[model samples]
Structure formats: C-alpha cells, structure tokens
Target: MKTLGQKIRERREELDLSLREFAKKLNCSPPFISDVEHGRRFPSEPMLEEMARLLKLDVAEIKRHDQRAPLDEIKRMTEQDPGYAFAFRTLVDKKLTPEQLLELVNRSKPSPKGGKK
Candidate 1:
C-alpha cells in the first residue's frame, strides 16, 4: 500500500531525476517537490495531472494505494471446496496449518503452453 507521496518519489527516482531537475521541468521550486515527496503537502489536481504526464505514470496509480478485502470470505469458499475440504478438516482444522491449502492451490495452476504464465 504505497502512499501518493511514495508513488511520486518512486516515479521521480525511476526517471533518475534530481529534485531540482524535476522541479525545473515542472516550473516549481525544489522545496515544493521535496514537500510533496515528504508528504508535508499534496499536489493540486492539475499539478498531479501534469506530474503524471511528466513522470509517465498513470494518475490513478499515483493517487491511490493498493488495498485488499479481508480474507474471511475467501477462506470460507476454500473450506467449501470438496477437493480441499477433507484436507482442511483433517489437517487445517486440527493443526491450523496452511501446507495442505497451499498444495491444493498449487495443484490447480494450469500448465503453461505457448502463452506466458
């Protein structure tokens, strides 16, 4: 879960641009860029848009952090899989181990053919 500031900094570093150099391109002060990178300030919408263009990053990627839903529902669904349910009851329920669950998932992977995996 990267913050917007971290995303901006990553993009800047990926381009190998110094803060001053990047600021020169953005027509802003290096202090302002530093502030944004340090999370002391947030860029305006227009500023974000411009930065996205300059940095070659997706605006949404820069703006949002990655998040995941809780795994409770997924766990319940996995419990219902007949192929895995026995293993889950016999091993996972008894020992609360995840080895069998991982093996079951690994077995389900499709073999790679011509296409990339």
Candidate 2:
C-alpha cells in the first residue's frame, strides 16, 4: 500500500530522472514536486496524467494511491436514500471485513434467468 508520493518517487528514480529534471518536465517547481514526494501534497488530475506518462506507469496505479474519500458521493447517496446511511452504520457496527462485504454484495445481486451469473 505505497503512498502516491512513494510510488512517484520510486518510479522517477528508476527512470534515472532527478527531482529537478522531473519537475521541469512536468512544468512544476522542484519544491512542489518535493512536497508531493514527501506526502505533503497531491498533484491535480492533469498533472497526474502527465506524471503517469513520464514514469511509464498506469494512471490507475497513481489513482489507487489517492487516499481521499468520495465524500460528496457518500453524502449524495445518504441524502437520496436514508436506507444507505443505515446500511453504512450497520456495516460499521458489524465490523465486516472487505471480503465479507464484497461477498454480501455478490449474493445480493440479481441472478440470471435460471441461475446466478
């Protein structure tokens, strides 16, 4: 579970690019890049895309390290259906593991005409 900064730094180093050189190529300041590598900041979506290209890494790999919660989506879901909020609370109360939760979701999905898909 490497942080985005850690992944970026490692990939950049593997490419033999200095911090300053990488920053120059990204059209950002070296200190800004340093802050990102130190986990004090995150790059914008466009910058992340360029970074992925420069490092020859997948955009999904960079996004996977984004730790920000989808707060807006969560709020919208809870507001649209209070049942969602209750379900979320129940999940927290039951302390269900991720695997168990995924299993529950899979079981709840509609089956095919004669059997499960």
Candidate 3:
C-alpha cells in the first residue's frame, strides 16, 4: 500500500513539478510541502482538495491514502467475523480484477417498484 506522501510525490513528479514550484502553485511554503511529502505532517481537507485540483486526482483517492484504518483493528474485525471478512475480501478482489461489477453498479437504475429513487 502506498502512503499518502508517496502518492503525493508520485503525482508531483508525474506533473513535472519541483517541490518549490508545486508549493508556489499551492500558495504554501516549500517546507510545508516538504513536510507533507515526507509524512511529517498531514494536509487539511481544504489543502487536500487543492492538491486534488492541482494534481488532477480525485479528492477521495488522496483522502483514502491519507487516512487509513489501523491494521490491528482490521485484523480484530476479521477475526471476530470470518464471514464478514470473507465477503469483504471477495468483494474487493472482484472490484480490482473485473469491470463487470463496476459497470453493473454504475449502470444500475431505479426500479419501477422502488421505495426510494
């Protein structure tokens, strides 16, 4: 799993941006950008939204990488309910490997007998 800093660095590089240049564009100090890229500091939500715009990444991608569930808690959850774990793992694996599920989800429409639209 890539860290938020790693993702930020990668995106910055992909855009051919120097740290100073990126910082200038973000209207923040270079040291702040450095801290964020080195994982010494986390960006605020508004800062993250700015990064998403400048880097052309979805805000959710940055947020997800930045905030992660602790591994120990995840392990405990899986241990407490193996069936839930299995189902979750299966869904994630399918999500990664196939487009069918994604397409189905994206293409889903309101049912004629719907309770909610």
* Clash number for each model: 0, 0, 0
Q: 1-117 in candidate 2: lDDT tens per residue? A: 778899999999999999999999999999999999889988999999999999999999888877767889999999999998999999999999867988988887566774455
Better of 1 and 3 by TM-score: 3
C-alpha lDDT of candidate 3 relative to the true structure: 0.84
Q: Provide the lowest-lDDT 10-residue window in model 2.
A: 108-117
lDDT of 3 by residue, 15-58 (tens): 99999999999999999999998899988889999998999999
lDDT of 3 at 23: 95
Cα error of candidate 3 at position 101, Å: 19
lDDT score, residue 55, model 1?
A: 92
Model 3 backbone overlap count: 0
- Each candidate: RMSD to true structure? 9.9, 3.7, 6.2
* TM-score for each predicted model, relative to the true structure: 0.54, 0.76, 0.58
What residue runs in model 3 are displaced by over 4 Å at the alpha carbon? 68-117
User: All models: lDDT?
Assistant: 0.76, 0.91, 0.84
Off by over 4 Å in 2: 96-117
lDDT of 1 by residue, 1-117 (tens): 576777888889999989999999999999999998877887888998899999998888776642333378658877777755575467645664346556766667665763324
Q: Which candidate's lDDT is highest?
A: 2
Candidate 3 matches the true fold with a TM-score of 0.58
